[model samples]
Target: MASEVVALVNPNTEAALPFATTLQLVVGQATEKGRKSQNEDAIGIRIPSGLALITKGVVSVISDGVSTAEGGAHASAISVSNFLADYYSTPESWGVQTSSSKVLTALNRWLYGLGQDYRDARRGFVCTFSALVFKSCSVHMLHVGDSRIYRFRHGELLQLTHDHSTNINSSNQYLTRALGMDVNLDVDYKTLSVEVDDVYLMTTDGVHDVLTEFEIHQKLTVLCQQHSTLSDDLCEQFCLMLNKKAFDLGSKDNLSSQLLSVSQLPKQAIDDVYQSLSSQPFPPPLSVGMKLDGYQVTHTLHQSQRSQVYRVVNDQGEAFCMKTPSVNYIDDAAYIERFMLESWIGQRINSTHVVKVVELQKIKSALYYVTEFLSGISLGEWLTQHKKAPVEEVLLLLKQIELGIRAFHRRETLHQDLKPDNIFITREGVVKIIDFGSCYIKGVAEISSPLTRDRILGTADYTAPEVILGYQADGRADLFSLAVIAFEMLAGQLPFKGKLEKCRTRQDYQRLDYISVHQLNPMVPEWMDNALKKALNIDPNLRQADTCELIHQLTTAKANQTVKDFVPLIARNPVRFWQVISIALFLCLVASLLNN
Candidate 1:
């Protein structure tokens, strides 16, 4: 058997832009040529967005279809690639309504069924599929088998996808899973916001198996410099170089490579450069009696059950809001450790949609952190006081919330607790995300305990179905909560409102009906309603697994709506209007007197 690899990309179609579709693919023969063949694949596409109704993108795959007793390998490979090409040509909305998981599952089952009915059971044909979808500044990946995806950023090549191999006990070399191998299958999918100048490479075992990570990085550095004109040419040259190197080293396997080089520099690097030239030095620490870190503290913020928040100076110096433990977290030691972990995680995250942490300090017993002083009210409080916000405002706020959360997802972190109190709306109409004390990093092992089991960590009203049942938490759980929040934000009521503690039972949680946003606000787009329903699904597997996808959907919906959909509801709530006006008048009077 031999290894088969294919690489394809949509070339830069527009003359004004630097963006181009680049796919580098390779296929090689294995030692036991008759027993097995290499099966590697890839796909790419441009999804619809407000920025571009028709996105320009590419999809490419290299698969060594299993050699069947009847020899259907070539046919199978052609079928898979052609199907993907046709699929990518259609609008993204026309595909599976859910996430990529469902799409891939369906594709796998369909291929597996076809192979089984061919009457060539002895001849097995399976291939590892790895794909990259790039559009604008984002990249989505779908992969399986031993093929790998690597990103070269900051002058280094970092492997992005994990290999599923049967040789885990030894060389970790056998393919444990592949499309068309079985009736049931699972696929790993992820989305990343790309920065210009970041290089992405997807390759079969031929290149990765022979070269060390360091050696690969070195080659990438040299190739990046030499083949700067044509990304595809660079990848081809690199593959040829690796093959020669492997043969020289007495390697005995097929060699293949797929490389993608992004020409634009990453936004982070640009931002860093700007900051280096423009940023001022950090201001000196405040004296004990001095104020203006934003919040007015009547007393020090104190720790509670699993969290603590403090009251501190506000900009006006007459009011206050809460800050939380900078150190000595009152939560269990593990929980307390999360505070520091969150700080570290926060550094990687940057989004105006999320609550902003102002500063962090480590004092003996007074270790405390500062953040924007939210003066208006929490989403929960607003809902209680004014019912639901105007449909437009609710949707706008939800968009902001999703924007912040999507930023976190870009950094591979999840806000495990996303309830009403955690969502704050400032008096100035800014939506602020709060309480990341329970956030978790994706792909990282979480601390476990009896208390952590099936026990809910967020407010009962907004907890997802899985969390209520004591199931493990993940990005889906956060999506579920976001759905609930969206429901409450529009409907002026919790999706499931009862005794909060009693709702912890799985059955009780499952019984709640998520009020459709459209039902509450007719102006809400149907697409949004559908997306929210999918997010709030009781079956975690059925829900939107990626926050970035959800954000995209919500943003599209918001953009599709009319101006009336965003009109502020404050005018309809006399109480809120009066309060805001009264505060403003008071400030105005104080300023006038000072001037006189």
Candidate 2:
């Protein structure tokens, strides 16, 4: 495999102000090459305001150096990265038109001059360059040499830059264009409209020479499924995987890849465009005389930040919850998609333990989702009113919750956020797990934003250890959360408590301790104690692998009683205790008299 590096830039250009653009670069060499032969360098700059001559948006640049029979490649690459970083850091004197292009040309000349001054320069410490500049609705890319730039849209691949290499026969090659090759350079530049879900990739020959474009595309698709946030760690992993793939194919040269993804359309411009498109008159609310599809919105049930839930009645007078995006989010395409996804996933998962979605509806100016209305109190209210249920009852309720979660896990889904409020219990003792809003289908993880990692999605107290550590959460994380809820149910208090209002940070959760629950509830059985301990283990690997095993142990242990349950006969009744003592004293007196 060949080593690859990937990154994602925020689509909200306004919000991405400080950095304006993001950059990532990685370099890899075969094990046979003992020392670092080449270096990867990256630079990012925010184009100053009023610089219309230059691009007004962000400019990101990356370079990968490759040298044969010389050690200057590493130094040359680092020098260029540092120089560009400094040049872009200050206010630019040149405007957007040619300011950026001019700056790059100057850098190119500097590299050429440096190479001419050194003896090893004759061999040429050449480097491939790729840069992305965002202005208004478009992105411009400049490229040279074997360093490549690729664009992906809707699962299709487009190679944006062609390699500049002269083939002598089959294997021997000479560079046609590169920075530091001569006193002058011929750079390839292209401009195109930037759209949401578009991804750009740039890499050194190390990546392209080893892994085919198809192979690189496949790995990117896989990585997108597991991660929504892009980081240095993820980039490193991508690079390592590529290098591994390249080595397997017998590549002996250095390798590197840089990937940048555009997750969302420019939010402001896109929102404005969507609003303009949806400028039609709103139809009057459905009246008693008119029908919408087949059901009537009998009344509006509730309204929240993102959407509204309505109480609807079918022609037969059956009730259902019809949810529609709030007017504010009506033009918000991303929110609409998320709402639809939640409804879709909820409908796919049909279980008594989960809330059910009946159907999805799209009307003028709005999208609606119909679901079954749950008639019960939320677990949060139940906990507050009941304080704590009997230990046995708590155990039974926990078993029910665990079984419900197991059902989801079996379907290869993980409820990313599970908490008391999202769970409900009817008066008839039926448990319904509600809120698939934060639920994620297993094996599909990538989303639009890399900043998603910074946003904590679930309730603080219930998040798992792995989640806190910024790892991809699975069914085991859910089990850890369920264990916390179990502990709270038995102890009448959370396992972790502090002055903080919520356990949002890992530090807030350090207060959790197993002994605390045991101290509060002495009636807790030894078997139950051990089960909770194992379930709440900080290390996910040490925790119970399956929730089914936990349920079985708790049920079986409840059935069996051991010596630990025994109490002295005298302790059961004080009067019986006195009589037994008196009889013992009389027997002792009789023995003494007989002996005399």
Q: Pick the candidate with the highest TM-score.
A: 2
Once fitted onto the true fold, the runs of candidate 2 whose alpha carbons sit more than 4 angstroms away are 1-302, 330-332, 360-365, 443-456, 498-508, 558-596
Candidate 1's residue-wise lDDT over 1-596, tens digit each? 11111111111210011112222222221211211244322223223322122132334444444333233354335434654545454332221212345556666776676667666664544666776665435666777777788898778777888987766465444567777777787777777767656777766665577778888899878866775444555556666776567556654445556666665421223232222212212222233344433444465444554444656665556433444443232423334334434444554466876766553332212223455556678877777876656666676787778777777665556687888777788888778787767665542221111222122277766776676676767678778778878866666655544333467565554555556677776766777776776776667776666766765676575653443223244523446788998999999999999999
What tens-digit string does per-residue lDDT give for candidate 2 at 26-65? 2121212212443443323333433221224556565656
Task: Give the candidate number with the greatest lDDT.
Answer: 2
TM-score per candidate, in order?
0.43, 0.45
Cα lDDT, all candidates: 0.55, 0.60
- The lDDT of model 2 is 0.60
- TM-score (C-alpha, index-matched) for candidate 2: 0.45
